[model samples]
Target: MSESILSISDNSEVILHFDLKLSDGSAVDSTRVNKKPAKMVMGDGSLTKNFEDCLRGLGAGDKKTFEISANEAFGMPNPDNIYHIDRSKFAADTELSDGMIMGFSQPDGSELPGIIRAVAGQSVTVDFNHPLAGQDVIFDVEIIEVR
Candidate 1:
């Protein structure tokens, strides 16, 4: 008798390597580059439902590429996500430069990355939108295991 193969499903645990790229062919991220595979449980909220759907129905050793719209991948950027912070809030030793990314702690103690857009005398404009927001993504996946 032959053994049955395990296919990806909503209840399955999966280990895979993936690459994220932009429309310009720029590489955003890739586990294969790091030589580290990722593990996740389906419906575990680690990934967007739409993105997870792309992994469904695949078995171990399966490789595929998928594309998702900007909204589906990182969502559209919101103007409100940008803020103007007082330069005085930063420590004197801290460097403040336009186009530099810095972390700001929220009330919940979570850190959010903000990109500095402008640095006026007292007011510094920072954008909190994710860098990948409003950009479409190409995802390449290699399924190492599905159980």
Candidate 2:
């Protein structure tokens, strides 16, 4: 008797390594950075629907690279996500600059990161959009095992 391979489906546990890159070929994120592969169950809200869709029919040892549109990946940035906070809200001795990422506490007791856009006189412009929110990306995945 021959053994059948398991394909990825809803609730299937998947272990894989992936490289996320910008459309221009710049690296965004990779699971191999620390030699740790990502493990997750499909439809567990850990991955976007589009991303899971790409792996639906793949089984163990499958290698594939696919492109994901910005809308399907992180989605487009929303202007409402940007906010201007009074400089007084920060510490008196705090120094602010453009391109700095700072964590802000949310009402739910979680920290949300925002990027500094500008430090105008008495107001600080912060953008809360995901850094890669507006860009398309390429996903290179190597499926290690599926169960």
**What are the RMSDs of all candidates, in order?**
1.4, 1.2
TM-score per prediction, in order, is: 0.92, 0.94
Clashing pairs in 1: none
Ten-residue region with minimum lDDT total, candidate 1: 2-11
By TM-score, the best candidate is 2
Task: Tell me the lDDT of model 2 at 32.
Answer: 94
lDDT of each: 0.92, 0.95
The residue pairs in collision within model 2 are none
Off by over 4 Å in 1: none
Residue 36 deviation, candidate 2, in Å? 1.1
- What alpha-carbon RMSD in Å does predicted model 1 have with respect to the real structure? 1.4
lDDT of 2 by residue, 56-121 (tens): 989999999999999999899999999999999999998899999989999999999999999989
Model 2: how far is 107 from its true place, Å? 0.9
